[model samples]
Target: MANEILVLGATGKTGKRVAERLQKKGIPVRAGSRQGNPPFDWEKAENWATVLSGIKKVYITYYPDFVVPGALEKIQQFVDAAKNTGVQQLVFLSGRGEKEAEEAEKIVINSGLHWTIVRSSWFMQNFSEFFFLDNILAGYFVVPKPKALEPFVDLDDLADVVVEALTDDKHNRKIYELTGPELLSFKDTTSIISEAINSPIVYEEVDMDAYVNTLRDYQIPEDIIGLMQYLFTEVLDGRNESIKNDIEDVLGRKSTSFREYVVKATQTGVWNIQNGQR
Candidate 1:
């Protein structure tokens, strides 16, 4: 009967959307992140105690990814803390096809808390909110192309699912693999956006080493580079190349397509060139 929901990573792509939805429904939420109440920092154990106080449920979205080294340990510790601090329900935003992420999911499953796993595919918002946005604006988005296709899930869809799990007990102990309606290669994704915005954009496929070198040139952190490598090498081996129906099963409607997302985003003028740059 705990009504308070603690949304960790509250400023992130899905967490922000989840918080907005919860607030709209008049649900009580404690925004957990450096930008909000109690200022949750993943590396700071001291921040954990206060953030979990008076919280009956938690929505956990680990930053940078759950596959990087020590992520499993961190999630285990965080879940243990949540259990000890009166948090009874946990909804985890999990990465699909990530071995380490799967391990983290297991930790949550074994916890005393009632849990739901929102195992998700690549997010379509990466183009608008993350590093890919700058690349998209610059007209050339580069990546180490995965041979297997990715069905990029919409953040809106993800938020919808997360909200459902956090609010409903029926979703407890279930794992929902969230994906879009269609499979797309990296090139196809950029092409769709180009068509949507009525502007030319290109997808440049680099070898894994080349992508690593590019990150190195920018002095991107080693841990981040490790993630990029893991994603490109391990997760993209066609294991998760297919679309999943779990979103439709849970939300009772087909998840938004990439094309639909791009069209909607286009209307926001987020892709419009600004101040002589994108």
Candidate 2:
């Protein structure tokens, strides 16, 4: 029998897609979640061994983000656990332009196991599937960094790269920086979505302080709020504005654009607002 690949954060933006793609190819997959047969939770260390059993490859995506405090230590501990459990390969999802995430990447690299690090830019799904979805449904898009340009990557492209890394040896010991084909500012992003959905969406460029306050007013957790602040003020400051062709190099195809993603998402009724509900 083929070895099972464990996908942590199995229900997340990238993990879900990665797991689906692997399973579609008839590969064995162990969904690493709190609800799995052998449950896995980052906060709980006792079950690490149980979750790692018979798993030859693991996809590691930290919850919240790798920029959070103590993330490095957690990653180190998990790497050690995976090593001791006889896992052979690891594929890690990391954030672009984050020093902290880079530190965590080092842990995976030196684990003495085959590893692939995928450093990714901001995901385009933020507008349709995540935090920005509600704002878009309300016909308004508010963010702090209006001038900073980002090469927002499609999750499908990211998942494709991750699956390849897990299943192939050619991607081993390689670091892939994945980004979309074009750079876009917040205004450009909202404009594309506005045109795609045929809706008049308001775009507001607020100061970081105002954005932080709004997050607090909405009762967003302080840890998440801190991650947001760091991403907007430090990481999203044009450092990752350049496009990358790593996705093409890995998948033998071009990365999906934000406008293409918006058009596809629009057809899914995720952006459709009816009676003030999404």
Candidate 3:
């Protein structure tokens, strides 16, 4: 019966923004992170009771991704725990076109709690805030699916929708497929970034096996590598090329376009090369 809302993965890309929005609105927020008070970790169920002790609602953003093995079990366990701890609502961040994610969504939907599912496409912030940033900074965007057209969703827009869902009961029992206004391939995205930053950025397409091997060579974790492979091979196979109006439906405004995101990102100087380093 507590008023504070717990945001799992509170330090992540979407969770961080959602938590900030809630705090700015003067809502009580309990950040769910290893460093948080009553710290929460997905691999550690022992901390769940402490983290959910006084939490009324929870914003769930599973780490690594929901597509991995054993994800459904973890989600099931967390959902059960949330129910036991008097959590009233759940706003789950899910991946677009991921079967495992959808299955996890099912678990929340049937949990007897107010629930909203934000099934999202690839985030535009990946170019600036995630693994792709290294490639962008290096001026070479290499991947297996350079020509796959994806309607990348802006994290800002996603955060807005998530915050609305968390605060508004009207969004409960809804599944919002969030996407941007337009579709763009990796090549097109790189070109836009290049123009925005006034730098030459190249897009290279390699085979999936080579990409996986390259990740291995870089010492990336096997789970992360498997995720990348699955994403590039299955999810990004033109399955998420279409845009959605869910953002506008939720926020009553146009979803941010990829080009618009690129323009704003450039102003932040994230793509700026400083002294031969990113």
Candidate 3 ranges beyond 4 A from true positions: 217-219, 275-278
Ranking by TM-score: 2, 3, 1
lDDT, candidate 2, 28-76, per-residue tens: 8898998876988989888999999888899999998887777788889
- Worst lDDT window (10 residues) for model 1? 269-278
Candidate 3 lDDT tens digits, 133-161: 87788787788855468999999999999
Worst 10 residues of 3 by lDDT: 269-278
Q: Which runs of model 2 end up more than 4 angstroms from their true locations?
A: 275-278
Name the lDDT value of residue 49 in candidate 2: 95
Off by over 4 Å in 1: 216-222, 275-278
Error of 1 at 57 (Å): 0.3
Q: Evaluate model 3: give its lDDT.
A: 0.89
lDDT of 1 at 237: 92
Task: RMSD for all candidates, in order, please.
Answer: 1.8, 1.4, 1.5
